[model samples]
Target chain A: MEKTWNNKAWFMVLPVLVLVAFSAVIPLMTVVNYSVQDTFGNNEFFWAGTDWFLDVLESDRFWDALTRNLIFSAIILAIEIPLGIVIALNMPKKGIGVPICLVLMALPLLIPWNVVGTIWQVFGRVDIGLLGRTLATLGINYNYVQNPLDAWVTLIIMDVWHWTSLVVLLCYAGLVSIPDAYYQAAKIDGASRWSVFRYIQLPKMKRVLLIAFLLRFMDSFMIYTEPFVVTGGGPGNSTTFLSIDLVKMAIGQFDLGPAAALSIIYFLIILLLSWIFYTVMTTSDAQG
Target chain B: MDFSWMAWTLPTALFFLAIALMLVGMGVWEYVSPGGNPRVGVLRFETTRGDRLFVSLLGSAFIHLAWLGLVGANLWWALALSAIYAIGVFRYV
Candidate 1:
């Protein structure tokens, strides 16, 4: 096949360019502007240079929030990936059970983020909530409000319940797409179940697994709403991830300069990490 | 267009302009040479010229930020370091 160059094709992309310029570029420019400037109040501004960026990078508060974010993301990925694969492997391949399982897996994902947070917030109350009350009855001191460990556990469990379905759905899609021929050949060779999975299934699911991993990593890193609604970032600053910290700086304390600087640094960190993940995964995939 | 609301200043404007020029220069280079001729670099992955340029720019941003954090507000040294980094990325990365 041959291709023809058509300059008119750019016209089709004009709308999207315009939209992005307004939506993403404009706001980003404003953030950059705010990042380098300081204001006392009421439109009076002074050129502060890179002071805010320096301040953010030097601050213990910013580092603590970042560490919390990294730990939370790491824990989420550790729990969700294997659990999702297991669930996907057990899912029915054919018949009415397939749709039922799919719908069940998708239900949590369909719920709005804030609503999910609210549900978990109420669901973990010692006074009336199910899990909290049960723990109390069992002579366990389970209070997410007071105990940092309990808060972390509740957040992790809440996240697993909410997001593990996405990974399962992705892996299931990968599983179902495998031709029956591979399974048949494995059976003919007298391969055990583990070998069949290890050799055939895992390889096919690699691409989807990568997608699920990256999606979960990014989402968990940027997690704010659920933790915010549930614990309100504390008895202290225990659950304050980067986004929560940014919001507190920007809106709560109205520290625009530092907040803007933090925003740029945060965005850059995600971009750099994601790029590394994509490069490393694809490179290994090519070699393997 | 009423652009005053954004509170743009001279240094910031120059910074953005430099970025825009770099992008335009890259686009022109691509137009002149076509395929960027990707090569495996010291990092053990394949990268095209544009990819190298991106890597350089991103690395420079971090270098500048790190310098700002570790050192003082005098950014001339940071700028020099970033320039050297960009050169290194172009040459080897």
Candidate 2:
């Protein structure tokens, strides 16, 4: 349906504009200012052109963190999407179990990020945490605090636990919205379960799955809290993603210019990559 | 009555209480208004005011978590992000 010209509708959006101006525009301006100028002591800044940006781009540390971020997001999307789909497929469709399962799934998503981090932190402690104690009892020297591999494993597991529900919920929403007639038609055609899913369910769920994929990608790429809490971006910077590294620079080291440049670069990367992904996927989605 | 185990400050309690009251107020508003006339937003899906509210709350929590982890302990940015998220949800989600 085409919307009629209504200049009055702009009035409805004024509040949003105001909100964005203060919340997004102002902070972004601060970052932009920081990205350009070198800061000394006592509220003094010197013009520093593209020096910070070039420095950040040249830094091996920045590149390493970016690589780590890419790898982590790639792994997360690879695991969570299929796993969530499988779980959503197996979930009860029409019973008391639906609500129970949904609530159980949603519980993790509702927990505060730091709280989730803290929960995993304590839960994986070698001395007091249950998982660590059990692993030790089973003769596995699993120490997340000391082992980079263990720290990565813990971070991945922590993320999966915290976020897989989002994918499941979106997929489930798509699943439940499929009309009963579609199933009946498939049954009349003697379609197998896999065939039904492929022809009917999967196609129907395309939009939501795209949403799931994008949401997961964005969230994982920006993941900071759980890993920061679990490993403090260590086993010696091994678990440090770009966001974690950026925080350490901007906040921990108080390096404003380089941090701001890194942040702008980071944001641009996400924007460019997401734009490409959306266009490619949506074109395929539209055709399929 | 020794309530030391509560683990929350007075301000935090009041904040929560205010939230509860706001939710109650929203409930009453919903009942009075009845049909929400769900409209298509940026998602191209028709969503009610309640759906927007739910989305904003969930998005706000994530924003807060991200801010806590990546930014400083200060909550001003989170509040800003939450406000933006709320507006986005109402306008788009």
Report, in order, each candidate's fnat.
0.57, 0.00
RMSD in Å for model 2: 13.7
For candidate 2, the TM-score is: 0.75
Q: Whole-model lDDT, candidate 2?
A: 0.84
The worst-scoring run of ten residues by lDDT in candidate 2 chain A lies at: A40-49
RMSD to true structure for each model, in Å: 1.3, 13.7
Q: lDDT tens digits, residues A1-288, model 2?
A: 997977588799999989997898657656766676777545667766556776776689988999999999999999999999999999999889999999999999999999999999999999999999999999999999999999999999999999999999999999999999999999999999999999999998899999999999999999998899889999998999999999999889999889988897888778656755775678678666
For candidate 2, give fnat to 2 decimals: 0.00
Model 2 / residue A168 / CA error / Å: 0.4
Best by DockQ: 1
DockQ of each: 0.72, 0.02
Model 1 scores a TM of 0.97
